[model samples]
Target: MSWHPQYRSSKFRHVYGKAASKEKCYDCVPITRSVHDNQFCAVNPHFIAVVTECAGGGAFLVIPIHQTGKLDPHYPKICGHKGNVLDIKWNPFNDFVIASCSEDATVKVWDIPKHLLTRNITTAKKELLGHVRRVGLIEWHPTANNILFSSGYDYKIMVWNLDSNEPVISKPVKILDAHKDVVLSMSFNTDGSLLATACKDRKIRLIDPRSGEVLQEASYKSHRVNKVLFLGNVKKLFSTGTSRWNNRQIALWDQNDLSVPLLEEDLDGSSGLLFPFYDSDTCMLYVVGKGDGNIRYYEISSEKPYLNYLMEYRSHLPQKGIGVMPKRGLEVSACEIFRFYKLIPTKSLIEPISMIVPRRSESYQEDIYPLTTGAQPALTAQEWLNGVNKGPLLVSLRPDSRKQLKVEKKLPKKENMCLSNGFDVFECPPPKTENELLQMFYRQQEEIRRLRELVNQRDVQIKQLELKLRNLCMNTGSY
Candidate 1:
């Protein structure tokens, strides 16, 4: 039987010190990796990024979705950071830009390659640095591409403009002393106007990104808000983490008035910390940490949340361990696990047979028109109708050199339309799991070798029996 991954647990006590639990944890460890709770999104389904503590001090792991289960020595290494990589976030608009914060007290923006960045960004591309202490958080502006924010133990937050030659030479557009202690976490409101910050001081502060104004501040005097989860609605936020201050409480807060939580609930009898991949869509959150390695799920809703307790499951990781990752599907716990497992490279893994990168066509234009059904809206109505008969796309350069906007307009009345047999690039062959395929090939070779050895042994035995029968016949004739 194949070993399962479900048996992995935090400690002997985590399985309630039962023999059955120990066996279960053992069955699951080899195949399973850690997972976070999210109503939607598979666990590490597709690794956008990874922050790890490895032999080299710290490492950033990037998994190219196209390279799924293959193991290669070189993947993506943005380089430049001098210490352990602590966090990573993909540029919300341009999936091309990735931001990673490090213990080196710097947050560097990397250009994620569609295929691979054979060259590290630091070798030739400019590097951006601003914080004086270990950077703790790096968040992209919810609304714009050029804007992003960084915070660290420096007791200050700095914002950056990715477009400039001097990313940080430009004074931080805004600065705020967000907390009395190290700012453990910071996040912006969904609209990009407000920023919520959590700190070692047990206080959560909301700031105006444009003006660096602290509009409201609240203290979980009963406990500390280790992380502040902002509801896009702006006036409200949900928080989870250790209650060094509520016995580790989970609370909902109205940022408009941060004096008191709208609602608060103590964790189950067990002391646990709130750490998870929070989902804005469903308003549910995952909490993990403290004494247990299991993840807890909760739904937060309300001017103040009532903190309805949800399901909990074991996520194997070291104590005081930490992880927060993307959620792209409903309970993608396994997906997350797959990506996590891919982070730690193994010996003798199969390397993917990759295709050569395609170069842009010689005739490719910098301002290529978009493909729409029927016509280019930029053309006159009659021209649009004519273009519809020709094809669905029209390339235009007349608008402006800098802003060549190519708009798509739908064709009307398909009464005489004829379908075209254009080939589909999307119909590429389905992929095979690199690991599973390699195992099958290895097993087949072993089976063939074993069969040949068995055949040789049978031949020798038959020869011995014939010789013995001949000896018996000779002895009878002598008698």
Candidate 2:
């Protein structure tokens, strides 16, 4: 009944032989929010952010992934949320911005310092208040910049546009009330047309973002669903959680009609929650479990059963949390596609795992290469604020961009303790004073407001042209 026996995995090697330093003291806090929900450490091209709990309580630590060191004594991480921070998400379009939801019932957006090498840089850009109970989830729209969706213990999902031009008290554009229980996780479709939410009630609901309507609903009576995600470009979905017998399970179902899963398989029971990272271009789903020393991936295709077991990559140590770098951040020259930053808090180390395809010939393999979603925002911050939503642009990695990587023999132990492949690591300058950062933050907000006004003007002109056309048609019909 489970695919564990049938699973096969490709080889994965450690990218950085040494672990990235953890700034905080190691504590035995589990990564799961509840019995089923798994928390993800947020990552971008520039930095990785993790919520840590020490003797002093919780602090949101944002560290440069490229650099390794102890916590800067003066700049002790950003401590905005009064209660435990449950989840954090990096803005897909803006590398310098991140959103964190906490048990304090608040979602705060922080502006990351451009230069991380300095000390004492903590700037809270905006604190969002709407949920009545602990807020657990905050996700940025895939295509829309600054448009964020958040859900909490109060069983309400709120849509927000982070344009600081408006008053702090009136930022939530829409408050959706449907879930009878806590909303566990949510995913937006490729085109941003539909939002699928998984609730603690063991039901998945497909929602109309514009109308706040529940278009369809599916139930899994077996057990509570932990995570639900939309399959790339396909009208299908995947969910992972527990079964009635308290076994871990993964299921694939049709989005239009989730009456029954196309495929459902049980797995070995473990307390660690499995967080899935999907690559739309490759149609591969990588499942990384907290407290597990391995990653299991499966390839999805347009066929019966839909999912084909690929392979698992094993390691020596378990992870407290994990963050995945975007596809655009991979080193294309090394035939690398995915890179995972594994957090080992016990050792105060962060390790990188690189998944690469082996090549022998000096030519690009057309079959294995596909265009990936670009990080660029589909619309400017102003356009997103003006109710414009669109899919992201795709960047093609073809011909010259793809190169054959020479396969090397596996190294033994500490002998291979060196950074592999050539990757560019940009250094951030020293941190700026709080006064200087506040001035820059306000200036950026003003610029976004002016851009919004220009977009509004264009909308008026477009409406006028439509009105004239309608009048001309009416006159001709009357004649």
Best by TM-score: 2
* Model 2 steric clash pairs: 8-310, 8-311, 9-311, 9-312, 75-120
Which portions of model 1 miss their true places by more than 4 Å?
Answer: 1-47, 53-58, 66-70, 73-76, 117-121, 124-126, 166-170, 244-246, 268-273, 303-305, 315-410, 413-479
For model 2, give the 10-residue run with minimal summed lDDT.
422-431
Can you write out model 2's per-residue Cα lDDT over 378-456, one digit (the tens) per residue? 8755575566778888775553332221113333444344335422112111224553454345435544755696799
Reference-based lDDT, each prediction: 0.49, 0.71
RMSD (Cα, Å) of model 2: 21.5
